[model samples]
Target chain A: MMKDEELVIEARDLTKVFLDFWGRPKVRAVNGIHLDVRRGEIFGLLGPNGSGKSTTIKMILGLLHPTSGQLSVLGQSPRAVSVKSRMGFMPEESYLYKYLTADEILNFYANLYGMTGSAKTERVNALIEQVGLSQARDRRVGEFSKGMARRIGLAQALLNDPDLILLDEPTSGLDPIACREVKDLLLALARQGKTILICSHHLADMQDICSRVAILLQGEVCATGSVQELLSTPDTLKLTLQAPSQTTLMAVLDLLERETGTRPQVDLTGRTLESVYIETVSKRKSAS
Target chain B: MSHYFGKSLTRISALAGLTVRDAARSRLLVSLGGILIIGLIGLPLLISGDNTLTRRLQVILNYTLSFAVTMLSIVTLWTACGGVSSEIQDRRLYLVLTKPVHRYELWLGKWLGIVALNALLLTLTGFIIGIMIWHTLFTSPESETGKRQACEQFLLARQSRLPESPISEKQAQASAAALVKSGRAPAGIDAAQVATELMKELKNARFVIAPTGTVHFTTLITTPLSGINDGLLNYKIESSRPERSPIPALWEIQAAGKKAIHLSVTNYPGLPNRLLIPGAVMKNAPSLTLSYHRLDSSSSATLFMAQNGQEPELLIPSGSWAMNLGRGLLMILCRLAFLSALGLTAGCLLSTPVAVFAAFFIMVLLAMSGYVESVATSGAFYIPHEGHELSKTWLDKVILSQFKGLNRLTQPLLRLDPVPLLEEGRRISWLLTTQAVAWLVGLYTAVTALIGMILFNRRELG
Candidate 1:
């Protein structure tokens, strides 16, 4: 368990009930739920559609008021202006001014963060290059492709160098290479002691980066723990070895059956389609 | 505190800048510019007016300037309605609200952006109109005297003084009561209603002079006439008869410390007349009394001076025309500022189309407030014919009360419209301009902004 001071996000009985025009309860989007995200760790909020993941994230970001709850972000109320200044949020969609260029958009956000002069320019430039949007920096976001717009959105979320970053569907429309880059970026940010809370449907990406995750079903948490603790099967034994001939494989299987009183299942470890696609694209670019 | 204010200002300015850029890059600015260009330049060319230089100038000022202001007002309301509501509808506000910006700052930033755009457009169009006015004055085919007449009558910023009525409302009411008791008025009619109608008749009776009869008017000039060589007495007369022929009349003019001057002249009916009063005669005068005497007993026509106090008035040169035009434009800009705030407030509570409709409804109601006041004051929706009793109903009373309330609320906006004054070349006094700013921008706009900010802060952007 993390100490109280080390907890970046703490919630108790967080609930959001959407109301109709007459102020009657229409939908219970988020039920009484509790969450705790510690410092320097990537926490994932996994849920299917209408399962309150987005609502929870929105409440944490102070975008929506909880019906009845105690929630604190970075040891302060989420709606506090100072707290917001110390945090960053990337919504599910880009939600940018369509007419503004990427450079202009970043500068606008930087200004909102009270940055100015040469430092603002330098940071904006570096982020543009980091997002691989240097060539498209002058183009308006309205003209950008979905993947390119997503990259710009990510860059803006990191513009303030916030201590706690909340991203919703960070890699929804990204290509495999961009997805890998984003995952790598999240790891690097965690290494630098920045807390991240992500809400996404991509379980593979969540499993790859999240130290701990909570699975929500119909506005309530169904399961939560570390990836290893939740995924490990206590009765199963797994091992990997170098490539072996068919006779060698059969000898190994027979020895396992003799030792364990059952024949062990065997399978080949294969590369993920995402990794293969990235490798192929990289190799093709190199050859060109 | 100063540092905090500085940072807040910086954020607001960035948001404001974004709004301006959005307008510039979108089709709004271009469309407005195109409309203004065509209206300002094409309108004067298309409309036909009298060949007199003064008449033509009046037409240009009245039509083209009015057109520009009307177009700008509609566009300003539309743009302001869409500016914030569209962003909210499209969910762009999600990203903005997540930042450290106070909701008030965001609301104020949008208002300032729309106001700034209006200022730019007003200034540009005003400049173009000024150039056109001057170009017409110098290049018209009229003679030099005609041009000089136009400059004096239509181009100079003059102050008008109307004669004060000698009769009071109390006197009218007492007389109305006597008539009602005497059964001369319709039964069941209120004395107050009778008094209002009686007052109009009494005032109108003062301007009508039977043949061989005389009528007098006294005008007090508050501002001293200095350096001006002449002042004008502008009047229009109509006869009870339909004859368009001229009638012979004698005018007796009296000023302080000066002898009464009398002149006999033939005045045409249904035409405007200007009588020049020398500066020497009016140099130190505090007031002037003029008496009109019908000279012909054989003529049976009863001369009726146009009432409403505007006719039979004195015009004294007060300021330069250019300065007056500038003040007029400033007043228009103040109105635009108020409209922007109103539109923003509506947008805060409604979607774009509904907001636009609500704002426009409000503007139209304000514009028609004069008629509303009349109807409310009369306590009837339609004018009752003479000798007709005004029947009362509870619903009528309730509706009239509502109309009165609306009129009271909107009276300040209509009290000092600059367009008519500009058309008549009357001075839009600095005091009037200051009051406009205070009432429209400071009072109305600030109130609307406060309501809008409160709503915006409480609104959920999720």
Candidate 2:
């Protein structure tokens, strides 16, 4: 929304070929991929397993070298240290040091950003609270549940207050509440003009947050556009309102048939399960 | 510049602290510590040698310290290898690497952390052994003979300087020539062999002094000695002819203008004799002169001072033992640093098991470097058939070349060993300690770390 949009990530024909011991190609994980993510946009990369979504994300994060072609993050090469300093990445799994406590992990990452003293302490504490891991701060990450570990992983990803964030399957293993919290966090980050690139298979989560998406299949982009433009059907329309009487419904169908030469499909509108669950939980919390 | 340096230091320190904390919480540290405690303290108690207390103590120092260093090396290697490879394998390294930290800092931090743990453990074990040595040598009740043995042998670090041999090279050459002319030489005798034989003959040569005769050594030492208040000489002697009993011999030792030490001994022909003289007598002495008189008119008295490496004189103490031990431990820390670099580098490029195995193989190769060097240098890889030499196979050439290259690589590290010096109670000089740091820790570790960093930078963390 805060756009005089500046490009944060630009790729042209990026490719990555994983090689075996003798330099024979084992898999072309990503091939001829092109991408552009701009500031203040939540961009999603959706794909099934082995579809090169993670590989592309890794290339953007500078964790993997592109086999060929040009790719840049923040107008610099993907391997540029300065570019990486302004970027944050959370891999698909909660890849965290098991022997470290949550507080320690956050502190460790904060220091990696050259922060120290009370500045570091405050930032670490803020992140731990932001990720809802304050109560588990002192517990070793090895002892944490999957959800707890994911929370800490998220906390570490934000330690540097990076301008660009890459989150791979960020909602995996998270509960619905936490999942909603993560979506809200991503939107909050985007509102601050922070560019986010998320790679996930959760279409609903992607729909709720991402403004634009690129769907990958077999290391190639099958579709890429704004979620609205891609999901909307120009030939169809839906009405969500209070259930109308038979007379009103018949009048609407007659008008549509006379104008379009066809009757529109009609069905009773129902609230999505996520919304109902959230509403019931909200109500229960207010009552409590 | 200072601000950037401070920030980098802070980051590196944080990573190192995390590494140390991780290792500290693991069961491996506790187990290694337990083993070290048992081995250092229990091994001394378990030994049942018939040797005297001093001999047993020397043996204990030699065995236990060597064992402790070997064990510490294994532990250090395992920690370094597993710490890096496991992080990478579990994808934990991705989190850290994604931060603003430089890749070199991560590897260096891990190495520093592992070395810090090694330092603490080694220092603790060293202190315990030191206390044990102190108790055995001084604190425990001992008889006069036992105390003398400890002082004259194990506890004191004596400096031995050889006095000039009375027999000349010309005389030794004449003797070797006479033996060869008498057809005593074997075929294909080289000049170097002849020289060696001549040196041996000189070492066995002895001089006899009749009544009122004197012998003088014109050039004994070129510099003044320290940490010594007196000189002790162990002499082996013989008589010209056998006697029914011991014969009375009178001797006087004089140096510079100082008063001579006079001694009257009932001399036995085949016995070890000790002579103690004031060190101050040797101060500013242009030469040392001795006079011997056969008090009883039986035969001439003979003195034999030749041995393999041992000399006639010993300077009782040259330096403090505590400083020596400190230097020894410093050398050990340098070696551990080298090993930490090795393990970390291997782990950077391989999986945990493979890295560990590779590091172990390297360690074994380094340990057997002397043997590898002999094989490589002696051209044992070459094949000889039908009384003619043939070139080595390509495979043999490759393996030998690899071993030779490794020898050149690890020789500096292996040469920094301090165990033998510690066991012998010889001072490991500060110069040697500095060399160990420069070559083993600074140079070798830096080169290895550079290679590892390059590989790690290009690595794809998939």
lDDT of each: 0.87, 0.78
**Tens digit per residue, CA lDDT, model 2, A93-141:** 8788788899888888888888988998999888988998889899999
Error of 1 at B61 (Å): 1.1
Backbone clash tally for model 2? 0
What are the fnat scores of the candidates, in the order listed?
A: 0.81, 0.82
Candidate 1's DockQ: 0.74
Model 2, position A17, has a per-residue lDDT of: 97
Query: Cα deviation in Å at residue B68, candidate 1?
Result: 1.7
Candidate No. with top TM-score: 1
Give lDDT tens digits, candidate 2, residues B1-462. 998888789878988888888877876678888899899877787773655676567766777888889999998888888878999888888778777677888987888898888998889878878877776766546787667656545554444455676667776677667767777777688544775777766556534445444333333645565414455555545555565356566667777677887877665666666665555666666556655555665444444433554444433345666777788898998888888999999999999999999999988887887777777677675666576568677787798898788778767766788887788666577888999999987898888889988987767888
Mind sharing the TM-score for model 2?
0.83
Clashes of each: 0, 0
The candidate 2 chain A region of ten consecutive residues with least summed lDDT is A1-10
Residue B196, model 1, lDDT = 92
| Residue pairs with clashing backbones, model 1 | none
